[model samples]
Target: MEILDHLDKLKIFIAVAQRGSISAASQELALTQPAITRAIQTLENAAGYPLFTRNRSGMQLTQGGQILFETAGRVLKEVSDATLRGAHVRTEMAGTFTIGTYESLAEYLWPDFLLKVQKDYPLINLSIRTDSQRSHLEELNNGTLDLLVDAEPRHRQNLAMWPLYTDRFSFYATKAATELNPETAKNLTLLYVRNAFDEDNVTIESHLKSAGYQFQQEYTFDSFTTVKRMAEKGLGIAVLPQRLADKEGKLKLIKAKGFKEGFGHHGIFATVSPHRENDRRIKTVVNLLRKQLS
Candidate 1:
């Protein structure tokens, strides 16, 4: 017969021999008992020997059957592994997915997200890069980032944006700065994210101007972690998302009237390339984030 016939009969023979009963092999293969027996009979005839001896003890493999069964088991296992490998290559689950985000959010969320992703989708490798909002958006546009998690969405025509969560901005300072009076606090300097301008530069500028507050710009940094660290060290007061500040016990919130309206900003958003909007992996991640964070 053909090579396929040999392979199929060998599989059937192994199944029956391992199961020790033709009826059990047929049940496992979703075939009738007669069909399973006939397949084994055909295999034994092709090899010119009896593969198994039937008795009350079910079925026992003859000498020839033992050799074929051992060889076939390994071959089937290799074929199964190769089939799984080929399937992985054809799907998006096995490759690396690059994610971009701001440093602060990355610090807050990346650890937990990485843990969950690893536990659930172990095959999907994740690479996270932390940068400023502007740089993150640039990477998204350049196709260097498969996904972007940011506080604001880029207004590009070729990007798809989805809201993830909203967080409020609050004023925070070290315990030392908390003792400063309002007038003194105004001059204590303010640690603001340089990239906040990308969100609403004009509004912030106008608000600062109206408040007659001129911050010492000498210690400004592009990194959010640096901003938080400086603020914790009592270097200056800072305007940060309330969630981040609240999580740090060393910092205390400074509630001023009208501060919320001026400083409050948009929440987290997921940005994907227009071309990758329908990509299965991206869609799966977006959906999972929405379900988890929403």
Candidate 2:
């Protein structure tokens, strides 16, 4: 296939960009770091964009690198996804597969995921429900939903989870707003989504409270979009997913040690009923989802 051929050429590029370093990429590909570095040099000559901008943080993808990464993700998905599709033949795969997830992830991430599933398996009815992860997990157990994709589904058992990606929370404020730290952040009203579960203990608010982080005036919104919009207008400082904030590009990241130390990072997982974990339909979707995001 044309897509497969294209993916082969970009495999090294994609692996390096995804792992953020030649060493990590080499480790993943089982190649020497020097070999990885030399391959990247070759790729840079062919690609119009330099592909990476190295900093102290490692190989940050340049605009061109980012573009290449996304493009490769779209095409290589046909291949990286082979884990799910590798051993399973889809010749007779046909059934309804429903994915239930939270509001923001569905809006920001799932368009391509669901679209690819539909394109590949037209016979299977694909549906997506975006209410709440908690309810979605329950629905999976009830057979109302086939997959529950969320940021670390908790408590419930008998479901097998596959890690897809990570979305970290960050402190965002108007570009003009005062720079924030744990102490100064208290001076600004905090706009955040209400914790869906108080007992979960994994929520941003719970972690902040436990860390002695304080927000003098706090506002809770049922929707993250509302919180983001309000924060953009300088209404208050907000803690939001870094991916969402990057898309807006207007909110400035606040340099708070607490926010910077990875307290808010959560792994996004695709979960399914254990019984159907190896079903062709399930594997196809999970690996496809992994390709789209990874």
Candidate 3:
């Protein structure tokens, strides 16, 4: 008779045979000693023969058991390989996965991108959290999130990153705003989005400082909505990413003073916990994003 009916028993037999002791199998499988013994007994009774021979050292496979072990191993390997292949092909997988991103991307970037994902993987549900990039990174590390889609954040250990696209910063306003440089920024109030969680504004300050960008007076708001609105009304110059600022084709660009084009550019990334780098769920989402955004 085929042992396929008792897959659990087959697994246990292989573990015991390889380890040479039921106790070792128990440790490997995280099962109790008595439980493993019961399983072995149940399997042997069905076959009308003991699969193992007892000895001073430990249990050794009987002649029939040795023959069955080889066949069982091949069957198990094939089953596992087939299952992995199914996942690799990105079909027949189900369940919801959480992805953390920024509010700007959630508004301008994800609508079309999400439609594409839904069309491709109808069963894969995505719960998108539009929070600050810093908060997303923390949630990712603390296991509250499965994946992250945002511009490059600080590299941390045990994290994996894949580039999606390069986004450049731009100056936008209702009218042709003054030239985008530190000197002109001091005259016109610099409008920028800040996360509520960023109490000290340390990250934004550091980022602007690196590019020699400084404004004597600034308009800091919690969301891009407020920043964009302020700029549209001719209140201040809005500093935003090119894709986000021009997504609707409403906002106009305010050219910079120097030969260098936009304020600066950064690579948008698909980040995840390093252990899940090759996971089918992660791979599927990342591939879709790369196709749409890159």
Which candidate comes out best when scored by lDDT?
A: 3
**Local distance difference test, each candidate:** 0.70, 0.71, 0.72
What TM-score fits each model?
0.60, 0.61, 0.59
Q: List the residue pairs that clash in candidate 1.
A: none
Per-candidate clash tally: 0, 0, 0
Clashing pairs in 3: none
Q: How close is each model in CA RMSD to the real structure?
A: 20.0, 17.4, 14.4
Q: Write the per-residue lDDT of candidate 1 for residues 1-294, one digit (tens) a residue.
A: 533457867667766875689888888789998888878778877788888999998999898777776567545644654465566886556555788887778776777778888998887767898766666665565455779987766476768888888776667887633333346555668887644532543343455556656654536576667778889888878777766776657788776555744264646889987867887878888877776664
Candidate 2: which stretches are off by over 4 Å? 1-90, 176-178, 194-200
Off by over 4 Å in 3: 1-90, 132-135, 177-186, 193-216
Q: In model 1, which runs have C-alpha deviations exceeding 4 angstroms?
A: 1-94, 132-142, 176-182, 198-205, 215-218, 260-262, 291-294
Strongest candidate by TM-score: 2
